[model samples]
Target: MAATKVLVVDDSLTMRALISGALERIPNVEVVGLADGAEEARALVERLRPDVMTLDVEMPGISGLQYLAELMEVRPMPVIMFSTRTAAGAQDTVEALRLGAIECFPKPKVAVPAELEKIIAKLGRCIKAAKGATLRKAASPASHAILPQIEWNGRVLAIGGDAASTKTIFDLLGSFPANCPPTIVVQHLNEDVAAAMVGKLDMKVAARVVMAEDGMAIEQGSIYYAPPGEAHLVVDGSVPPRLRLLSRDPVAGARPSISVLFASLARSVGADTVGLRLNEGDDGTSGLDAMATSDGYCIKPNPAGGFELSKKTMTQAIIEPELARMVLKLCSR
Candidate 1:
């Protein structure tokens, strides 16, 4: 297999060196070139034609966001943004993701050797994943005149997605009306990014979207996003259900493991649960499989169903809850 070639783009020499050294340590990953700014990065892209790019969120000259918009317009490739763990940085990182960046990694505050190693390993994994990601020009949000209203039937919708499924998640949520079913999300993202994502989704979707908190009540027309780090989100087997945040060891190398969430849903909601797996691979396959065992509904993002958002018409297409309900009906059959 050919090594995944990567270009490091950062204004700081030290940061560039850090990213380059980290990428070089990963197996089958080659640091093809380093660029200080957007122009240099663009030049290097034309010259080296690396398979992936690690870009800084903020850069001199043409800003990283500006460069990203232009890059996606001309040469669409997988990009991972290196961001700072701050409010402003999180905002920019989310924008970058919207602009078609595959992943975003927040720089460690202390930059200790151990922390750096962890970041490096994660970055390498993201870079490798990026190679398989579908890159396209960013799409504008679709216009929906009428959001469908569905009856709340004591069922829960559990959605799990990977880095490549960010847009899909947004579109899925947009499909729901103000009185949509109860929903839980287990998207792989940093804590800061997750918080920012919840805020962003809350505004875009008619339902209330928030970060999962310990003992938070599960309500219809609300979406709870599992927080990143060491805690796993679980549903308490109580009446009018509540969410529990558990501090357990990571499962399948994911703290908020999709499998864990699915298993919990299977035990709690059982046949009433609808599990949607978007752009997730083996790490979440077992969980979705387990959900099937419990006779819950499981759905994969089918290209024909408008999960792919690259098409302008698809972006503007109305998302029907009836489509999901029909899938559940088929599962029962």
Candidate 2:
């Protein structure tokens, strides 16, 4: 196989040389260019076109976070952030991940090059994993956690979520009524665990659920789901439009980005749209707030609910089916 081309971006010449040396030792991995900072990275990205980039969290003009966001918007590439092991650095690294970096590397002030070499090995694996991973998609309207009553009235209800947001959808759709709204979800799930999640959810809810298709119609009792791996999904203007797929990269570390759906729903259903999210990270916080503030009746998971995942607690203290019925009743009123 041809050598995997690499780019090392850092303001520190020592740091760049160390990273380059580590990569050089690795078989089939080639360091193509050394960028002084984000500006250089941008220019070199156009010229060298490296397979992967090792980005520093802090730089001269534009920070790594800012650079990554700009890079993703224009010519997208896989970026692994090399960050300091400080608390502030951790926060920025998380922000980088949310902004679409593959992963982060914590650069500690260590004694030997061997210590840094270990970090390089880990970085390489992360790059390889990201290149093969799938992205999240927009959840179907039917997958709304706080789904509407299965009235099958006139329009369809769609829902979508990513890794940090799908659990909120599950909470919002608990004990859903089969007769309620026709729903769909484009949840971002891993391959090994993806198949199991639909059933774990289906057994608790009333709707007969199935994976989604591009041409499926909006029905009264059934909801469909699309397994979004790495492409973004959107709905076109149709008599209940079909799910359209795109080769675009991720948004806020999400494939079926909530922003994409919320924007689409605002265009499609207008005031009829309702949205919700449980803030797991900054990505969730921003997305939920934007959607709610926009003329849609949006709900957020109450942090007061103490619904922490690691704590083995659920924040959805109330059943969503009842909430859905309540929402429907209010809409009729």
Candidate 3:
């Protein structure tokens, strides 16, 4: 297997060295080149043809977000962003992800040896996961134009995905009407990132988006995101189901596990549940299977395009505006 080549881009000399050094320590990764700014990074990218890139969010002259937008337009490739864990930085990081960056890592505050090691390990894993990830230009604003209204059928919509599915989630949710059915999302993210994502979605999407809180009622016309941290978000088997934050060990290596969420919905809501699996992995399959057993509708993206509903396939891009039309057909009263 060929090594995954990486380019490190940051204006700070120390950060450039630190990122390059960490990437070099990974077993199957090679730091092909390092650049201090957008111009140098562009030249290096043309020369090195790196498989992935580590980009700093804030750089002098052309900012990282600006550079990322340009790069996605001209030559799309996998990019991971590094940013400080500030309120503004978190929002910017979410924007970068929405713009096609594969992942975002928070820059270490103290740079202690122990914390650095952990960050390096996680960064290596992210780079490996990003090796063959598909990068596409951001969808045009027209793609998010509002969809026709539909009355909810008292069905709960549950969506689950990992980091790679952020854009799909944004696209799908953005097209939803302000009065769409009750929706719950479980995207694999850390606490800070999850909070930022919820904020971003609430601002941009027509539907109201909020982080799921313990004992919050799951109501129609609102979207709830499972907050990532010490608890798994589950639905209590109540008359108008309410969200429950259950503190337990991580299931399938994820807290707020998608499997846990789907299984809970299957048990509580039965056929009234609809599940969308966005990223393929073992993490969410078990719960999806449980949903299937309860006669709940299950949908996932087909690699060829469109979506798979139960065993049947629909041939249309899941991220297109058409998706809202299809989902409405499935869940409308």
Candidate 4:
């Protein structure tokens, strides 16, 4: 197979070299070109036509975020952002991801040799995964109207995803009504990114979004995000389901494993549970299978566009708004 071509864009010369050097060390990756700012980056993009790009979140003239927006409009392609882990940087990184960047990695602070190796290793894996990502312009949040309130049926909605599912999750939850079902989400993220995402979702979406806490009641109309760390979030099969933060080893390489959450929902809610898998990898397949075997409904991306159920019996693909409507109908019934 041909190497994955990459373009490195950053204002600092040292950073450009550092990133390019690290990428060159990885097998099956080629640094096609390096640019200092958006203008140079734009010209290089037209000339080099790289498969993926690594962009610094902040730049001198046209910011990385601004360039990303323009690029998505004209020629969409996979992009990964590099930013500091500061509070302000985290907010901007979240915005970048929402704008269609494949992933975001924090820039090295001290440039310590050991730490740089670790970060580069993770970035290499991200770059590899990004080559297969499907890129498209992000839809305006205003375009999706909030769904109408549905009758309460004691059902729960569970969502699981990875880095590629950021925008989808935002759009999906944004369309939900203010009093939608009690929803739980498990997205593979670091603590900083997870906190920023929760904050953004709480402010933008109609439903309340909060990080899950041990023994928290799974209430209606609220969305709980499983915090990333040593513990996995699971649902207790009680009279009224409650969230539990269980300290366990990472499952399928994710501490907040989607499989653990889905399996718990399958046991607790049975058919009352609705599971949506967005851009998730193989780790969640078993959990989704468990949900389906227990008679719970499962939805996954259809590849042609929109989403379809995991069951082969239903093959019709439905768009995001229709998905929200279907979830409402299913839970109400």
Number of backbone-clashing residue pairs for each candidate, in the order shown: 0, 29, 0, 0
- lDDT-based ranking, best first? 4, 3, 1, 2
Least accurate 10 contiguous residues by lDDT in model 2: 306-315
Best lDDT among the predictions, by candidate number? 4
Give candidate 3 regions above 4 Å deviation. Answer: 111-114, 140-143, 311-321
Over the stretch 268-322, how does candidate 1's per-residue lDDT look in tens digits?
8777787777765665678777777777767665544533211212222223334
Q: How big is the positional error of residue 71 in model 1, measured in Å on the Cα after superposition?
A: 2.2
Worst 10 residues of 1 by lDDT: 309-318
Pairwise TM-score winner, candidates 2 and 4: 4
Over 160-219, each residue of candidate 4 has an lDDT whose tens digit, in order, gives: 997778888888888888888999999988888899999999988998999999999898
Overall lDDT per candidate, in order of appearance: 0.77, 0.60, 0.86, 0.87
Q: List all candidate RMSDs to the true structure.
A: 5.5, 16.8, 2.2, 1.7
Reference-based lDDT, residue 231, model 2: 59
lDDT of 2 by residue, 34-78 (tens): 998887788888898888888998887888877877877676677
Candidate 3 lDDT by residue in tens digits, 1-333: 899999999998888877787778899999999999999999999999999999999998999999999999999999999998898888888888888888888887765445568678778888888888766778743468777778878889999998778887888888888889899999998778889899888988888999999999998779999988899999989887999999999999999899999999999999988898988777899999899889888887676666677722322345444666777667798
Candidate 1 lDDT for residue 147: 52
Top TM-score hit: 4
Q: Residue 147 CA error for candidate 3 (Å)?
A: 0.8
TM-score of each: 0.82, 0.46, 0.93, 0.95
Find the number of clashing residue pairs for candidate 4: 0
Rank candidates by TM-score, best first.
4, 3, 1, 2
